[model samples]
Target: MNRNQHIWLSVFFSLALGLLLWKLKLPNLFIYSLPMYPTAILPDFIEPALDPNHRKFFHSKRMFKFLVICLVILLLLASFKSQHYFFWFFGVLGYLLHLIAESLTFKGLPN
Candidate 1:
């Protein structure tokens, strides 16, 4: 699918996640939905400036793994009476969802 389609899908995913969190009485309601859509597509915006190969570098398996580990660790570290945990948690969620969707595209994903 195209970028717009991917974006809408990501937004839908994010919103659903947010609603689930809200229903479960999780802290920071809609936090993931708010910034996740943009966060999910950020690589598409930055890839041109960062690399000619685009998604290959930014969306690489290694990068995704590292990002997930770092975000989860940071989220856990900041979870205790800290508001910043929301940013990290939502960012990670959005990024993961974006990559998962992108994997289905013709572009596929890097190693």
Candidate 2:
């Protein structure tokens, strides 16, 4: 997918997550969604979309799993009220959502 498509998907995902958090009475809703926009397009920034086959290491399944693990760790750290937990949480959440969007495309992310 293109950059614009990625951004829209990210926004949709963030909104859904925000709604869920709102229902759960989670605090700092703004902080949770703040970092998503930039981080959603971060893979492209890290590995530019020069061609159709540009989804390499940074956009791979391995990286997705790594970020999932990081997300879990951030959640754990949030219990301690870590000062920067939500920043990292939303950042990784955006990256994960990006990969999910890419994986839905015809040219899915690499293994």
Candidate 3:
């Protein structure tokens, strides 16, 4: 339940949830709009910007909760507009699973 454990758990849970969602044939859950040609690995460039230690906003629980709320609202909006809701639901569920897994590890508490 240390930092390493937390990371591993989060990764495992996320991957498992992603696999499950993929099996369910959901769409738009994993889509990203990036330039066709990338100069570097996307995560490497993105992770530091999103890293908690770097004062990233989304790294906090409050921000995460806010995100969930926003996602739910978006999902409802999509449903109202007759758009697909499967991906939204699946994506939120997967993110929540990752958060929960991280919570179970020691890293859940503030340093």
lDDT of each: 0.72, 0.87, 0.47
Where model 2 places Cα greater than 4 Å from the true spot, the runs are 81-83
Better candidate number, 2 or 3, judged by lDDT = 2
lDDT accuracy of residue 88 in candidate 3: 56
TM-score of each candidate structure, all chains considered together? 0.78, 0.88, 0.43
Query: For this target, which candidate reaches the highest lDDT against the unseen true structure?
Result: 2
- Candidate 2 structure quality by residue, lDDT tens digits, 32-94: 678988999999999988899999999999999999999999888876877478788888889
lDDT for model 1, please. Answer: 0.72
Better of 2 and 3 by TM-score: 2
Q: Candidate 3, which ten residues in sequence have the lowest lDDT sum?
A: 32-41
Instruction: Compare candidates 1 and 2 on lDDT and give the better one.
Output: 2
Return whichever of 1 and 3 wins on TM-score.
Answer: 1
C-alpha RMSD for every candidate: 3.2, 1.6, 7.0
Q: Where is model 1 more than 4 Å wrong at Cα?
A: 48-54, 81-83
Please, what are the lDDT tens digits per residue for candidate 3 over residues 1-111? 234444465456556655665787843443411111121122223334344343234344775586579678867876787455544554555445444544465446232
1 or 3, which is superior by lDDT? 1
After aligning candidate 3 to the native by TM-score, how far in Å is the CA of 12 from where it should be? 9.1
In terms of lDDT, the poorest run of 10 residues in model 2 is: 25-34
